[model samples]
Target chain A: MTASSDIDALAAMILARELESALSKRADCGFQLLSSGQEAVAVGVAAALLAHDQLLCSGRSIAPALARGLDPGRVMAELIGRASGPCLGRGGRGHLSQPSAGFFGAHAVVAGNLSIAAGVALALQARRDRSIAVCMFGDGACGAGALHETMNIAALWQLPLLLVCDNNLYSVSTPRAAALAPQRLSDLAAPFGIEACTVDGMDVRVVREAAVELTDYVRNGGGPAFLECISRRYASHSTSARETRGQQELAADRELDPITRLENALLSEGALSAQTAQALREQVRAKVAAACAFADLSPLPVPEEAFADVV
Target chain B: MSSEPVRTRRVFFREAICRAVGETLDAEPNAIVMGQDVGAFGGSYKEFYGLFERFGPARVRDTPVAEAAMVGLGVGAAAAGLRTLVSITYMDFVLLALDPLVNYAAKARFKTGGQIRVPMVVKLTAGAKGQGVAHSQSLESWLMSVPGLRVVAPSNVADAYGLMRSALQADGPVVYVDHKRLFPTSGPLNASAHEVPFGLAAVSRPGRHATIVTHSYMVCVALAACDELAVSGIDCEVIDLRSLAPLDLATVCTSVSKTGALLTLEEGQVVCGIGAEIAYQAQARLGPVRVSRLGAMPAPVSSNPVLEAASLPDAGRVADAVRRLLMEG
Candidate 1:
């Protein structure tokens, strides 16, 4: 397929799979994995990334890692705690890691991934290689010292790193207005003199287009770019976590349900047929089911080897 | 175990640091030093003097005063197959670089499910002696708290060279600490550029009377204490622990298991210091034995030489601890 067609296909695959899992005719439809309505944000930015590009995903942006080449099967297993999971059933849903796939785990510690991504990107820079390191964090990470330190260093050295912030309006129950001093998360990069951009996270293309520009800028020694993709979360913070969190999901979901938006766009443009979308939905469901089955059939980890990887 | 007579040597603490680093670069082609002013301007401590001229600018890189960035770059360079020795002037300065050292470099191997290996050495000047409270601080205890980090503090001239060599060759991130006080003090090296394995213990002196467990500069103090104790019929076996993370407990325990008495010395505060860990380890091996810790008494270090001496362990105190332990035994 052509490059344009390829991007479209990738977008379609992301929307279809995520929609089937998050909102579909399946029995487990409306089963929320991520709390934020940021599926489009992941699909968009992930489409712009090269397969070899590394990702240090923070506590937010769960869908991005999977889109960026992490085996969806492994992630599905990881979310439910299965032997075949990428994290070996060690890390729960929020902490899945697949280093081989360049998907570093989601760290709860705010702005923790910035330094990690910067370091990895700096390593790539020293080698003079053309590989981008993507760090997807939330608004909370902007306030962290690690982010500022990393951004300053990254900018000074002109490291190839993409620091994307999923400004999901709130950190759990607290609104962004209550936590961050600045209204826009991208503005936090101004002090470090790093390039910053704000995007419409509801439309995945906006994120993808911005990601393309940012990726080029990063590789060309424009330094780290802070892209604030303002989106909202649909689910509660955790499993059945109902305490009236910030960023009303139903309204945001209506305006920015990535799967629905993508489907409408592709259908209207004659790029994707409704029949094709339906087929893709079924295929994703089947794939997830097969993954669940594989996880069930897999053997339990050796009890003695519980602390195998830990120092 | 070098029988060769000591050759004439004179390099000031700063000069020796540069000379030693230059020597390391001379020895290994893959080895490079990178930090702020490490290239053209030499370094804050002049530890990387003349390196820019001989090794070229790329090998002796000058990074911005961003410790996190510099440390992260070191980790990256190490993983990309370069033996990088990144230095921050003081141990306290490592606070800025703790993220890379703690999160990325140290936990990379374990967190990645043992896929990647970080082989980098961080040369940090530890301990204080009028370098001011900010510059003169020991963060070895902080480093020890981190898992997957090999903490090495070479008390004197020989171990400084040996520790740097070993840490460069190590499979993981190694924190090579050097005290400001012991950098100038000349001592016999077993062999210049020899690999002093990370977990090996140095028997500074062999004696059967009492086992004095100490490391870094304190090893010299313990050795001198043995001389003083000789007059008082108390001979102390001073074991200089070179490595901290994978502490050479076998060597210290063997010494303590034999002498049946242990004493720990630290240049930092007395509470929750390296001595406490050594005491716990020694006691665990050789059933309950009274251990003496020689260090500062919870207060900030005094600027006065005499007051500093009081806070720091000296030969006199080490000898007294030995005599008292013997009396009790």
Candidate 2:
């Protein structure tokens, strides 16, 4: 294999390793809002990304951000408000930033990144380069007008934009059925004349296949594409959601864990043994311990840092 | 319309605007123009006349009556490296395009940590004299409240040329407010290469007693008032606030600080307007003085010529404000 390919594969592994460690470890520490169900969507997207592609994510993007090579220690550090975090601790967890990985910081405002995603896509077109923009918003975000406006514009201009909606059923406590009008999220882009696709959020391989096709389609001049991954968030909204929702819905979502599906699939294929999966879990635990230690030891930002990085 | 000669230089405001559109296209291969009546009709106000001949249908484009969609398309075009000029005929029509202009075009570049530049200039006409409330609104104040927008209102030929060039070349969105009345107003010529830097006030007339600060066609009224003020022994300096956003507060403040007196003139409503912003800053910077302002009264402008005259601040009101400041001093 080529040196670049080798590096790409290795980086993907490290990112996944770091993410697994960060997610499992920080889940308990950072309000226990773990997204164990959306792992497939995240892994699929992260796998399909070109190194130069920019990933502008919205909140509830734990899996995608981690999958995109966000450092384990930095994710943990950000969660714990440490100096070494992606945003230097100013933006912890949901507001993470990893510029080197091409992961622009996550936005808290729902669907606000729609136009921003178009802007980045436009930037890619302006440079006369081949890089595409990957934006992940929830089904809740599709309801926002900015999303519709951006989709139409992106499609009209044939912009290199890969808009992915990780429909985790609920925005926070409100289900997609409650917040969004159309039952299916991909319906949002149909009127915009953009190509639309859907995938089982529980299957990373399926999602990976879809992403590759869509990315290539857009790269070959197909206009912006929207892919809706009907995923589930197997954890609380944040450290705060567990207290906010009743026990029944959260319990229902737990039954659809993508991590378990991947693990089971690996076992069936003999790529992984039961002992191997257990060992991987143990490794994740150990890595989390090290990252948490690093985060805890990190320093607070100086007073001058406040005025810096205002945007 | 008066039987005025085709003072080509005075009429350069519309020419400069259309020329900038065509020139920008010639300068940058990616430049395009899209709006109602732009392509075939040559624009609703004839500002975009002959653009189709210069750049063809692809670049000199026409868009549907979707104001919000048009702004969104402009944003996309800008992001895609096309210096797109999206002209919404009336400043009042901006109400339809506000969401896109306010939320997307304005903040997209900054919010992305400089990932993109919406180098899109929205050309709009305000201050229509005889056109009723719907058409004559100087909504520059309404649009100025949006952050990340460099709002500009040029009063004369030089500004018309300069501001359009600056807006066309900017890395962010600019709302270039063209006054309906000042379209024919003339000033010093700017030849072929004309550019107006943003956030700098244009001093039409210099004085020491006090400064009459205004923008757009009102600059002419302010100058006329300055002339009247000079007759009455008031050395009134008229400072034209060309670019409204990155406001040249320093210029206004320096003029106010030097002459301990100030008066503001606008064509919009008097309350909670841009004039209020200037008054607040001037009061804090250059102690509370007898500051006066002339603008449209709270009531909307009527079709009656006399009422229309009273609706918007005239040269007499500007001179009266200057006189009030001088008397209080």
Among these predictions, the greatest DockQ belongs to 1
Q: Lowest lDDT 10-mer window, candidate 2 chain B?
A: B2-11
lDDT of 1: 0.72
Tally clashing residue pairs in candidate 2.
4
Q: Give the per-residue Cα lDDT of candidate 2 at A279.
A: 68
Predicted complexes: DockQ each: 0.36, 0.18
Candidate 1 has a TM-score of 0.88
B171-281: candidate 1 lDDT, tens digit per residue? 889898888777667655543446677889888889887888877777777888888888867767888898888789999988988888888887777677888899998
List residue ranges in candidate 2 displaced over 4 A: A1-36, A70-105, A122-131, A236-245, A282-311, B1-11, B29-42, B48-87, B92-124, B128-149, B186-188, B192-194, B227-235, B299-310
Error of 2 at B157 (Å): 2.0
True contacts kept of each: 0.26, 0.10
Candidate 1, CAPRI quality class derived from DockQ:
acceptable
- Report backbone clashes per prediction: 5, 4
